[model samples]
Target: MRDFNRYRHKGAFCLMKYAAEDGSEVEWIWNSRDGVTPFCVSNRTGDKMLQHVDWHLDRRIFDYQPMPCERIFVDLSPDRARQRAERTIEHYWNRDDCAHIRQLFGTKEKAIEGLLAESRVGEAPDLVEFGSLEPGAYRR
Candidate 1:
């Protein structure tokens, strides 16, 4: 169970505060002085402070329960979920032209582009293979 609240300051700014499951106090405060950026803070040291863009991308921030509940579950937006999946999936590129040459990219398109760029002028695309390595999965 967790508690959440929104506090307003003289009709100028708003801040959202919540108690984490781990008993830490978390707050998302906007910098009214700058009139732009918003950042997150937690009483617990070493906690990652999320920036405005990060907060917007996270669906959990907007799904807080006003009343105490057993648990709260929030699903990531389709675009955000896909971005997360891409992060964990490592794109790999290798060409038959060089047995010892292999490279890793963050996206499939980049992997293929890398392989094509490294190929000789007349080299066939069939000599190259682009694939993704699952998280924690390895190959020789």
Candidate 2:
């Protein structure tokens, strides 16, 4: 089977292309730094999923964007993930309050997860819905 999923916000759209082999999932998000490692280690068996809804504006990058609160998630390759790690390090270097954990992961998913943890200021939004992949790509 063929499937496509998209997460659309005010200014961003994150799309996922998965075959039936990849499973059926609606959202992907990690709620806590402590849970991230376990979730990853466990391959999402009990991990929290991102809820489908309009994400809040990202105040930091919003000025540059027509919509300020959109969060975009793109699938990452090894190289891109490494590049993201480097970029995240640069972005946080001047901020003493930054978390060292962002750069700990070897992959972009991990690093991005770290970024989300560090940048989050409020509770996770309520206008969202999360569902496990029908078949799922991974098993814990």
Candidate 3:
């Protein structure tokens, strides 16, 4: 067999469909998130397996780990992912579709900060209203 012990693959945009605290299914499209690390060697057996590992491209290698989610899967392309992210943000702002999620980000400023931190050049801006970012404005 060809050496697949230390292989890496390009990442892509994907939707993370998960259950809320109320057991409601929510689909959130993640844009520009870290890609999956497939085909890893087992530390104990040295056996190669397609164990999925999540990468934190923006952080150090030590930050990488297996995804905690048990049901995340791909949903669409990058363009669609951007559109879905926009819609998700709109729901959060207008109807508080996932209010509990804010607790994970702390203050509103911190939430905005988190959004800005992940933004890439020429990419879609966050749907959350911020400085000069009018409500419902999804594009930069």
The per-model lDDT (C-alpha) reads 0.30, 0.32, 0.35
In the range 1-140, model 1's lDDT, one tens digit per residue, is 32324423221222333334454344443221102222333333546443233332332233222232211112223333344444433331334553333334645666445544543322111100112222222111
lDDT of 3 by residue, 24-66 (tens): 3332323222344223222222333223233333222221222
Which portions of model 2 show Cα errors greater than 4 Å? 1-51, 54-75, 99-140
Residue pairs clashing, model 3: none
TM of each candidate vs. truth? 0.19, 0.22, 0.23
Collision pairs in model 1: none
Q: How many angstroms is residue 20 displaced in model 2 relative to the true structure, after the best TM-score fit? A: 29
* Candidate 3 off by > 4 Å: 1-5, 9-34, 37-76, 96-140
lDDT of 2 by residue, 1-140 (tens): 31213223332221212112234544333221111111111123345343333334212221122122222222223334444556876676545575454445655566666655544223212111123222221111
Worst 10-residue lDDT window for candidate 3 reads 125-134
Write down the TM-score for model 3. 0.23
